[model samples]
Target: MFSSDIKIHIHGTSFTIHTPSGKINISLPFLGYQNISNVLAATALSFSLKIPLKKIKNGLLATPILSGRLELIELKPHKILINDTYNSNVSSMISAIQVLDKMPGYKILVSGDMSELGKKSVLYHKIIGNTVNLYKIDEILTIGQISYEISKISNNGKHFLDHRQLNKYLKKIFFNKNKITILIKGSRNTRMEKVVEYLIKESKKHVNFVV
Candidate 1:
């Protein structure tokens, strides 16, 4: 839809949006083409309303990072946490995985099942697994029944029965890794945000929650 109206040229962390009036250069703090698309959607509406390009640019820049949606937190120096526990689907998963793939460090993907997929549940899970492997994500930890399909296909993935098992496994591995980026994702039923909570509390309280 934006192909003709809004032309986006991406270079590194910033992108230039071409418009009828001029250009709007945007540097969103978060990652993903989806976010840029969203910005374009807003920009299109704004342009139609005759809003100034400067105001649109400022608004895009001023937009805050929403929690559990590409929100960045430092577990420690060089170790980053991506709290993408807001929701889960094939599209969102791929976007998050792509973001993680670009980051330089020991990458870990902590994921849970994408519910209500009906007949294509297994296929969806397999796609996620293949994408992770294709992107060369270091470790893929998955929970729940359907997500087990992800681990099955991922080269470095391991399926866990529950959060405790996953946590224990995480503690065992990553004992020596110094620089790491951990992205947690899941549907609401999976309650993957608890993993984020567990990491936060454990990072502050204990010594075993490495990486």
Candidate 2:
């Protein structure tokens, strides 16, 4: 459980935890409560190993996000992208959506598919849909057969047959956006990382070329 003194800010969160020695204040470079929960778990493990609390706090603050695993990218003057294409499941999908809900801007979830479920894949997808609705996500865009269930259940969702079609739609929607945050996710088998890469590449298109 998190300490009651937790302060979540736009860019980060700070919390004070009681330890045997006294109280230790911890801070992170990111704001997601799920991210903070992971840090708390890691801190517990470190405490069990008799590691110094100062070092634990410092280490947590310095750790960098693994690429394509809830990676946060700034899209120039107005938008942000959360690339969570490393893997997808009922829990992780919900966690990612929760993180997106904390962000500022128009929230969008881009999903591919969660694979390797012998059965109940559709049910799992529907759970994510319910979660999106619960959080009142602004929109959900989906690709793939199993993932389509998410959009179908969401109040404002659309399904794309292919990446090109989705990308085309995103470009149009992304134009002149005041503020937007997109969370892209799927299992490795779905190759959703391609969509992340395409978005990043497209974001750099407007950069002035000095030649």
Candidate 3:
């Protein structure tokens, strides 16, 4: 029920499709090319084959947003929190920092090291530190080994190598009366949710955790 020939022009590459699933003829433009042509070609072929559009629409609407990935929770004036701890890659980390930098309120970064970089592990950690400095983050609290590296670059931030250290420090400093805003972020493995939990409404000693 679809066209015999399907075409996808990505990066100025033309892929001509024949069968529902067959070898595709791909021609890419000059400079910076990868073999992702096969993926594009296959997608085109499958799309042309026989997939219901209603199923795609239903899937898009029903799919829930992944946790800790740009989850916004309102608390008080200028004290909103964004939970972006579901996953962490270099690009995602930089984007989170950029969001903090652009927004107002005393921003706090409770982040952990991004995992699975293979050989560029240390280099990536250092890049995180450098980006923090460039963004001029107000405060940074990190747990775990590599996360400590990120905190070290902050001129006015605290680094915690373990959860116990972080918990003790937060207990002392996270006052309920203060009017400062906070942002908590990290990799999913670090359990950044605990920090958010502690900042909930029950704790009256510190600034209002929720407005």
**Backbone collisions counted per model:** 0, 0, 8
Candidate 3 deviation (Cα RMSD): 11.0
Model 2 residue 210 CA deviation in Å? 20
Cα lDDT of all candidates, in order?
0.84, 0.79, 0.61
- lDDT string for model 1 (36-144, tens) is 7787788888888899999999988888889899777776777777889999999999999998998768999999999889999999999898888889689999999
- Residue 72 lDDT, candidate 3, scale 0-100: 58
Best by TM-score: 2
Candidate 2: tens digits of C-alpha lDDT, residues 96-195:
8888888877888999999987789999998888779988578899999899999999988899999999988776666556788888999998888998
- Flag the better candidate by lDDT, 2 or 3: 2
TM-score-best of 1 and 2: 2
Which residue pairs clash in candidate 1?
Answer: none
Q: Over the full model, what C-alpha lDDT does candidate 1 score relative to the true structure? A: 0.84
Instruction: Please write out the lDDT profile of model 3 over residues 1-211, one tens digit for every residue.
Output: 2344544444322344344444344442211122334444444544665654344334333545455666555555545666676778788788778766755666677787678878887778778887888885678888777877777776666777677677666554545425454567776777887767665543545453333
Pairs that clash in candidate 3: 75-211, 175-206, 175-207, 176-206, 176-207, 177-206, 177-207, 178-207
| Weakest ten-residue segment in model 2 by summed lDDT | 3-12
TM-score of each: 0.78, 0.79, 0.60
Cand. 2 TM to true fold: 0.79
Model 3 CA deviation exceeding 4 Å by range? 1-66, 171-178, 201-211
